[model samples]
Target: MKIIKLNAIDSTNSFLKEMGQNSTLKNFTVVVTNNQEKGRGQVENKWISKPFKNLTFSVFTKDFDLEIKDQKYLNFAISLAIFNTLSNYKTPNLSIKWPNDILSANKKICGILIENNIKGTKITSSIIGIGLNVNQEKFADSLKNATSLKNSTNSKYDYDLDDLLLEIIENLKNTIHLLSLKKYQELETGYLNVLYKKNIPSMFKDRNDVLFMGKIIGISLYGNLQVELEDEIVKEFGLKEISFA
Candidate 1:
């Protein structure tokens, strides 16, 4: 449970990786920054936050004993952990968008990027990077959908980043233990229970920008999204195959 705090860094994930390369880091080792110069998001998207106004950190965990085929469960567990943490803060209508985006009342509040190091067919380690909007009040026009904890709660609140970090790490510890204990069914079912837009018809766009309406059925074993369309047609879409419109 080694924690490293940085005044500023290019990317906490990269920093943690370099640290791991230079020396052995214990499980649950964390690197947090008050100012992340270049934060990353899912699928190479950029995560933007005002300096010292949000949460940006990465966690290094090892000995998952997880097969490469079941890596989605790791994502599920981490997502659930973040969701639980936010819910504990009384964030209203918390839901996880597929593949690790946390939404609050349909507005984006958090983003996660998980990179795994594999040895043979099993995962040897995972670098879980998280960027949670906490106190930022203004967002670029390009990120019109983004919102923060203070904005959502409509308060001039100042949060102690270390306190929130502690809470998140605790949640991750519990979830990771469950994962190692082979509580697959419980974690997977719990993930689906909080899945955003589940069983509700919503607009989605294919990579070609063609829009269609579908209801999210469930996630496939391979971590693809299963959607049932108007003609009773069901299909599974992986990352970048589909997105909310």
Candidate 2:
């Protein structure tokens, strides 16, 4: 539970990864920053956040004894943890957008990026990065779907980033414990229970930019999104292959 706080950093995930390679770090070691200069999301997508007005941090853990095939459970566990924590604050319509993004009222609020260190058939360690929009009130014109805790909740509530970070970390630790115990069914059920747009007809765009209608049924064992399309044909899509319309 070692926590390192920095005023600014290029990327918490990068910093922690370097530190872990050079020295032995305790499990659940965390690196948090008030200002992240080059934060990134899944697949090298840039993550932009207002300095001191959001939660941008990374957690380094080597406690999970997971096979390569069971890695998706980590995503399920972390997403559920953030979903559970935000639910306590009464974030309206909280749901986990597939793979790992937190949404409130259908607007993006948090993004998670997980980097796993693999050795042969097992995962040796993981660096989990989270960027949660908190008190920031405005977003760039291009980020029209982005929202923050302050904007999502009533104006009367004062959101503290430090408190929120600690709470999420605690929740994460508990959820991650479930993973270590191999409670795969429980974690998957929890994830699907609050999954966004589940069983509801929605539009999606594939990498080809072709639009289609489908319903998100469940995630595959390997973490691909399973969608039920026209004529009862169910398809599994990877992260880059599909996106919500």
Lowest lDDT 10-mer window, candidate 2? 149-158
lDDT agreement of model 2 with the native: 0.94
Per-residue error at 130 for model 2, in Å? 0.4
Pairs in clash, predicted candidate 2:
none
Summarize candidate 2's per-residue lDDT along 1-245 as a digit string, tens digits. 99999999999999999998799999999999999999999898999999999999999988689999999999999999999999998889899999899999999999999999999999988999999999999899999999988888865666988899999999999999999999999999999999999999999999999999999999998999999998799999999999988
Highest-lDDT candidate: 2
Runs in model 2 lying further than 4 Å from the true structure: none
Question: What are the per-residue Cα lDDT tens digits for candidate 1 across 22-64?
Answer: 9999999999999999899877888888998899999999877
Shift of residue 188 alpha carbon in model 1, Å: 1.1
Which regions of candidate 1 fall more than 4 Å away from where they truly are? Answer: none
Reference-based lDDT, residue 117, model 2: 95
